[model samples]
Target: MSRFAPNRYRGKLIIVEGIDGSGKSTQLSLLSQWLRSQRLAVSFSEWNSSDMVKGTTRRGKKKQMFTPTTFSLIHATDFADRHERYILPMLKAGAVVCADRYAYTAFARDVARGVSRAWVRNLYSMAIKPNLAFYFRVPLDVALDRILGGRAALKYYEAGMDLDLSQNIVESFRIFQSRILEEYEAMSGEMGFHVIDATQSIETQQQQMRQIVMDRIGAALENDILRSPLEIDRAG
Candidate 1:
């Protein structure tokens, strides 16, 4: 049996995952806007944003003190805190919960850092499977260009400098992100990720994503709309 089970909550959980600069964040933002425009209850979460562990993560990164195992465990703690505090409660309240990254991010990135895949998966075994998981697929070169074009320099950890992949920060990012990409590809089939070609124009990608989301949960959203106070007032 799969370690992660489908959630039984009334709300829908939608998540997007990809290596950094894959444009998954942009797509999720657009989707969240659309969901709100439809009057569906919507909530948002981002990985590593939990206050509980953010300070520790920052200090560790600043000091370059995190080994792969400690990094993995700290992130797991962050996810756990968010899962219990924000995700579960909002989901139970029937809010459409959108996440920028979920456990799969850890699965891919942690394993790419040389953590054991089985151990990492076991760490996130309590996570509820997302109703829709989108993997934004982009070529490494394209993703690199996009990231570097926007930023003056890569942060040390973001470049995967801790792994000693390359002396060049840009090259290190390329190699590190490549490993993460491979992990995502391997898990896509097993985890049923809807892969999006992220190299396309932003509008086109967003259109396809919106359509897929509508197809998956349009009826449920419509029901929520109908039950909303404004709709009830109109009917009365």
Candidate 2:
């Protein structure tokens, strides 16, 4: 068996993933706030952090240049950069890291966009897998409406496809969602995934997420509180 590294602090890496407008941002904020209240050494990061891909995706209303392949590649680069610079370091520091989106989005959306599953997975080979990933399940239409509610006209990649293509996309999302749902269900048994009732009100979801984070970081929060400036200095 591969034993845990004692000098390396293995903080729980938690990720929340789902289709656009699945309320991932809201849930991430709530969970981070709850962790702070409990005094846990937590760090927050996002995939599209004001980066090119996010800007490109947001520009969907102006012009659509991103195909499924382009979208997948952008996310792949985004995560690889994020993992190397932010995620891995914090995880090694024993600080809980919460990510708003992760590789699951690439897997789900790329498959929905007709990209081969193997190709998409290969692009993300550098990403450090999260210990726990929570997927918020919602219908495509619900997600679409929520996303489109913010604006009008398709941007670079957000072009609403033609009827036949649109149907295909929705169907793809359904197929992709179903596969991910099954994977998450199986992972639940192994403590890698925790499925939340996303259909519930946002408040309820926040509460549940807070409880989960608290459960994971209980000891860490206490340790931080006990470690005064002098104690930390001595340890350093």
Candidate 3:
């Protein structure tokens, strides 16, 4: 489970992962924009944002009708759609692709929900390994507090309502997120996740993230590792 070395990739794929309220989305968005500001071509993608399956997924969630296996398959399909339609093209265009969450998200969440880890891994074998995968580590209480403060009600799946872990919403979310954090920690070594202490100020966390990403960008550019499917067309 060693990480896919950045040397092997055509374009940099940076993935940010964490439990709910861990600030992963915010940091990734900021980093992507910042890279663009520096004139690095960039394209952003997020989990479950594919148009092909959005309506179906939303309806399933609304009715709370998806079992663990069904939920995993739906998300896997969504990821596959986006990977083909959005991610691959961006990478082939030599754009830095920053994904809010990637395959590791399924490896953690689906396993926590009772899907077999090996099955999930095999399901995502089509995935392109990320060049940089950052795992935002936050304390359960802190994440719960932040989520509660921002929203009036927790989403059913996020609260682990599907698992029936607890009666109280807050307690359920806490239990669920804690399990997800444990799963994330377990995969850190195997996935080469750059773990960040999310308790740090947003500025500090972002600074550290940028420094690492910038270094990778420089190395990839120097090695000409980013020339891709459109190299001939672009040259013409």
After superposition, the stretches of candidate 1 with alpha carbons farther than 4 Å from their true spots are 224-236
* Candidate 2 lDDT tens digits, 1-236: 11212223456677897666678888988877776665667788887663645666666424655566776777787777777778778877767788987776666566656788678777876666665577787665676667667756443233324212435554543445455454444434443557777777999988887776568655555663222132355655
| TM-score of every candidate relative to the true structure | 0.94, 0.70, 0.90
lDDT of each: 0.91, 0.64, 0.84
Residue 99 in model 2: shift from native, Å? 0.7
Candidate 3 lowest-lDDT run of ten: 222-231
Q: Write the per-residue lDDT of candidate 3 for residues 148-170, one digit (tens) a residue.
A: 89878888997889999999877
Report model 3's TM-score to 2 decimal places.
0.90
Give the per-residue lDDT of model 1 (tens digit) for 7-54.
Answer: 898888999999999998999999999888777888999999999999
Clashing pairs in 3: none
**What is the number of residue pairs that collide in model 2?**
10
Query: How does model 3 fare in lDDT?
Result: 0.84
TM-score of predicted model 2?
Answer: 0.70
Alpha carbon lDDT of residue 189, candidate 3?
Answer: 88
Highest-scoring model, TM-score? 1
Candidate 2 has its poorest 10 consecutive residues by lDDT at: 1-10
How many clashes in each structure?
0, 10, 0
lDDT-better candidate, 1 vs 3: 1
